[model samples]
Target chain A: MSKEKISSQEIIDLLSAQTDFTKRQSEDFLKAMFGIIEERLIAGETVKIKNLGTFKSQWNESRKSVNVQTGEEFVIPGFRKISFTPDSELKNLVNEPYAHLEAVVLDSNHEVTEVDDEDTEELEPLNILTEQALEIKGLLSEIQGIPLTKDESKIEAEATVEIEENNTAEIPLESIIQIDPSTENLFDKIQEKMHQKSEELSSLEVVEITKDESEIENSIIEIDDNIEPELIVAANNEESKIEAEEEIKINEEIKIQENDQTETKSNYTAPEISTSSNVYEEEKIENHYTENIIENNDKDEITSIASDVNRVSEANNLIDNSLDPVDYKIKRKSKWWLILIIILLAIILGLIATYFLSSATRCWVKYELFSDENKEKTANVKNNILNIFGLGDPEIAPKPAKIEQDSVAIQAVAEDSIKVDSIPVTQSKDTIVDVFNRPRVYDEFIGTEKFGQGNTLTNISKKYYGHKDFWVYIYEANKDKIKNPDNISVGTSIRIPKIDPRLIDLGNPICLKKAKELHDLYIEKK
Target chain B: MNHKELISAISSKLSISKNEVEQMLDTTISICTDQLKEGITIGFQSFGNFEVRKKEERLSVHPATQIRTLIPPKLVVNFKQSNVLKDKLNEI
Candidate 1:
């Protein structure tokens, strides 16, 4: 059998091979299933898989304990735990490989003791070597004992155990010491434990009143000599108190970070329970100190402790203002008002667009007729419609259509002679034509005659004006009927216009004499 | 809900065949086991986290039989719900 554990990728590959799914699809399916299971479990539901197993959860209550050696009591907080049990089918399948194998009876206890004896035999040389190692530890403790007590050696050993338990993979003491600064609160805890031990030692000292105080002071001086010269220099200066304050603040900050301890504890993953055991010691010591402080109700003692408490509080305030990092919550204003404004603007714009599109551009059909008379009739009909609507005539005035007499005669001669003759007609006169040419009303016709074949404006002019050169005037008067001045139909009556006297050449004596005679006749008539 | 209800619901939500959902669910158990064997923690945010805790070797006596057994250290899967989900449950 392959020793390699089945990874998610491997499962995906297997699923892809077995089912009609790609590796990615298999992965997604697995994720979705796991997500569902997690969701159900979180809702306090027991997940049961038929013929496989069932998964459920239980709560392990916190256990309270007291350590006899340190007289420390603490509680291990309660936590939720999950459990699983396989069904019979799955269990049978799992046990199938070992079914044929029988359990062999062995002297496990005897074998363990034998192994232990062999281990001790192998450790004999190391034990002898460690005898020399003890001397170094003895010297180290001797220096430490001046500041603390015999109990501290055991505490130091326990602290080392706690460090080893925090990270069993990395056993180096230097690495553990490096982590000490970060675990400054834990160090404060150690200090608190030392203080309690010191109290106990002091109480014991009270019994030995004969003991010389100078010897203790001398031992302290010796311990001071053993310390680094820089520390001694710092101890002698005023700045030392500030440094101590900063150190205390750092530990207080660590205490403030209790929330982060849970995540960090997971990172430790220590197999041994020594770290928690140390926590018990710290908790017990805290309770003990609180009790002691409460019992000592004397004013002098209270005042002394109160000063230290005040100083610590002042340091904490300084640290909180200068060093404490707080989370800043960024406020985000809602955009509903802006959105409403935009929507309103859009609605207004749409309304305006629609209004202009429909009302600004008016559609009307402007009909144009080929015949001028038909156009005039249509205009009259339109004007009648406007009158019904209580509106005046069109904004622009209409022009009257002038029909040629030839086309008028064609209709009168062919079908309406009686009607044409009955209508009052103007008499033809040369003098009338002359005055009509002056831009005055020319209601009197200059001349009217039936059009003949091969007749043009020149022929008509020769007949009406006594000169063919005056043909242009006739053409101008009848331009509506005569599309081309060169073409005039037979039997079509034509209207001749009056000639301008100033346009006539007086250089011809005969023509001038005729013009003068006409002028005299006109003046005599006047 | 029971297994059948669970299967039906998954089928409707995923819009897949019931067989497919069943296969995928079976695969989940194996995957969890594999991860647990490797000491890997699988976490689903706002829902729960799954991890394997190591139980140390110990000697235990059966209360009824009065026989002692040496229980070897073994890995076990642990699941803890996220606070968000826990709060959701508290409302009920």
Candidate 2:
């Protein structure tokens, strides 16, 4: 940042250690410098410092751009450009003192063109030649350790003298270095393009002439019929060579078919021949030689060359620049749309998954984890198991438990509601309807019962009545035997009988001997 | 009502199937948005009323910085249940 002259290498080495670093560090530093300038410029700000110069923002006006794929135009919004100014010291350092340039322009007659006072002096070739030729020549000369006679190179020896004359001088090295690295690519492309144009122009076919339809009878000709040469002789102007050349080739082809027009009635090969010639001509124009370089050398004939061929190359090269606006706009819009759609879909899927996942998680939380009621039920079942295995407390006896039963005539029951008042053995219809869900459940009934093991009722029924559901039949048959129905007398000898009275009606299976005896008794009694 | 009668009634009305109706009901019932022009009230017969009503903005403190700021005014959907429907459902 100081005004003192210093080598760029020294400056780079001073900041952030580089002694044990790799080439990547060098790239990183350079990238950082470029990135800073680029970011600031893109944000529409100017970077300025005294002497070293100011980099100002240059915003481009919005304009139309084209899409290469579809060849469509779109609007590209205005962006920015980076501009740099070199400090006098940095300028002096970057552009080592160099030799001067001497100029002379030759006219069409090879005579020196007289200088006109009205002409801008900046167009004088001395500065341009110095910047282009002398600068490179000096650099290359220094690198190769060769001596140069160019005036610009000689000034490095006379650097002491320049310090006295100019207070703040421009060495023209600022813009030169800042021109960007890709200019070399542009230069090579330009050269390749010029060569292509030149080749295309050189390949255009010689034109031909054809006889008229009405003149087919006059087979004899007085002239050589070389109309291709007629036009070459017709206009000597090379300025009109391209147009005149194509017409002459067509005329020559026409001449070749004059005698056979009746036989070759169709359009024939004219289509391919014409197009090929056009392609040849286009290729000729595309490979235009470095016209600018030649343009500078030959200002007089340059006008004609540019008018005839360079125009075509210029158009192609402009298309190659890729500064189309509309294409970039479409790309930007689609980029946003793509991002939007991705985010939208992600959100929708997230919501659906969240709904299902939350419900499933809630179910797991309720049923699988931390359920106190379930823990109690499992504890009781575990106790029962332990008692069956004679591993539980002996004081808690393996008591045969009573089973719950409903009043036979009861109907509906609330899912969550429990009966507060017990239904009597002979309850009213309304009470039955509210107490039990169905008549089937009332077949066996009990007001209240103690909880038991899983097979307690089945085992007890088998022990006393030799039937599992006989417990229910006992409760129904002795509806008045016990008031509480749930409270049974420990010593009561209740009569237990067959459950279904209809069992007496179904005929019993016959014993063979009893069947014969019964038949003999019936016959004797008859 | 018993599941048999409920399923049968819903199935016969839809003519398609109860499963299909359940799917449609699934889509129609849950959280969703209704765009309200300047003034409008959405009425879903037994469900409820979603009314776009004027909401007044007031000053409140932002929790982060404890800064009192005035929020903007806008219309918000306010829901109110139909008493007739709510009573009928409570009875069931």
Candidate 3:
């Protein structure tokens, strides 16, 4: 396991051991196999080996590029590359360890909620409480006047009724205590002062009730022309007592007509009064009740009224508590919306600024590129930009042509110099004709060889001429022995002619140009 | 060349029977496959290296429907050509 890399030699050794072949035989087989695969791939044929993989050659298209430092544009010539795709069995075998693993389909909404659970947990309870408060507020508004609709009101009504009944029973004893000598005389003046305020409130209430009676009389007179005075007296007695009792009863059955005066006044003024007003009302009611005890004037009425006021104040306090969080939440939501809007506005402004800045820079660059004075430099820059963007340009089309012409001109100059220098050598070897039908001299033979299986003229040429392109010269030397240079039979005897130093010179560009020309000529002739 | 031609060529080059060459090739391939299954890199000098590579799991979305699909991770056989082979191929 520690030795991760298995070399080709090891594979050959393994093959020899497993197949009962010699090491040399396995080695030669492996070489021939790989060589044939390579040959087929180079010939643009796909080689598919059973239980292994398919090897194919892919041609990459030529692309344009620019040098980073020099900013010079150039084209990268395309070449073929070998690509191998493994067989399905091999793929499955390699993936055997992870074969059991599978892909799972995930619900987007479920995943999102799971990710947000931490943040939502902190916020959820507050949201639930607020929702509950809103529901309670709606229920309270619907049953605001009905006391039994609220749990606290139901219990308080029962307690108040019991207390009121006990006070009625104890009225005589309370009056006797009021008549006691020492404490009665001392409380006399405070009792009178408190009685004055109660008298005024009661007087105002009587006036409002009388006005309500007048409206009722007008409505009754319209219905029946003659209304009896006895009936009016009965209405007043029942109205006053019922108004007092309805506030204490805290029930839904309270007659709307009888309770209208007091209920309307309480509804109009209750919510406007703050907690301080509530304390003042409590103090005033307590003093008024003490006065009622001293005077012994309908003590039960005073007790019931006091209890009703206390109940109203408690209801108001409950409402205030419920409403405060709602108001706070509204204000918090408004603040968040304002902050979000401000942030959006800032981002929009920043984006606008950046857009303008980029446009300005682009305009400046365009102006510099299009200006007449920098035409030549701009052309070069334009070419570099086009190369960078992989765009073709008409101006760049002539650049390679000019380079080729210059190369041809240089080769012509070199050929002229070579002709002038090789006059004596050409005159000595007048019998030998070159591929171009011109007399060319060669040095004495370096060697003689027989072309065998797997032997190519290019390989032979590389051995002697140091380049595969010089194979044209080998073909020219073996023209009489060979028919087609592309197809040579095995065991063909071929001569390896020693070329003149100037003709096959590696440093001279003319040698390569001449060899290329000869190659094109021979191919055209074939 | 195909399997038959490759086997015949190897047999002729090594002067062995085609059956022997085919057996030797099958053994070589089986051994290489076994070694690769064990996660070893089989390197051939002046040719290429064959090894197992792990492809990571990924999420792919359909362009039109926008349906997300999870691609499970798997081990795959990979081949990387040596620089010598690359240079030889580019020589053409």
The best candidate by lDDT is: 3
- In Å, residue A361's CA in model 1 sits off its true spot by 99
Off by over 4 Å in 2: A1-11, A14-43, A67-70, A88-99, A102-526, B1-92
Once model 1 is optimally superposed onto the true structure by TM-score, how far is the C-alpha of residue A445 displaced, in angstroms?
99
lDDT, candidates in the order shown:
0.45, 0.35, 0.57
Using TM-score, give the best candidate's number: 3
- Give the per-residue lDDT digits (tens) of candidate 3, residues A1-526: 2339899999988888887779998888888888888878877888888899899888888999999999999998897777889999888888998788676554453332222233565356566777899999999776553332333333332323333343443434334333334323423433343344334433443444443444343333312321122123334554443343333234323333323432332222211111232223323333432432332355576566567657655654654454345435433523432333335434654554555455555654464457663454344334444432335243332232332332233233322111111111221111111222345544467887778765688888888889888988878788888889988888998888877654666764646777888889898888
Ranking by TM-score: 3, 1, 2
Query: What interface Cα RMSD is found for model 2?
Result: 36.8
The superposed Cα distance between candidate 2 and the true structure at residue A208, in angstroms, equals 83
- Model 1 regions more than 4 Å off: A1-18, A22-28, A57-82, A86-526, B31-57, B61-68, B72-92
Candidate 1: tens digits of C-alpha lDDT, residues A333-448 = 11232333235434654554444333322210121234453354455445433432325333422111111232233232312111111111111111122233335333456777
Worst 10 residues of 2 chain A by lDDT: A205-214
True contacts kept of 3: 0.70
Across residues A160-181, which tens digit of lDDT does each residue of candidate 2 receive? 1222123122334333333323
If both were scored by DockQ, which would come out higher, candidate 1 or candidate 3?
3
Q: Give per-residue lDDT, candidate 2, residue A201.
A: 29
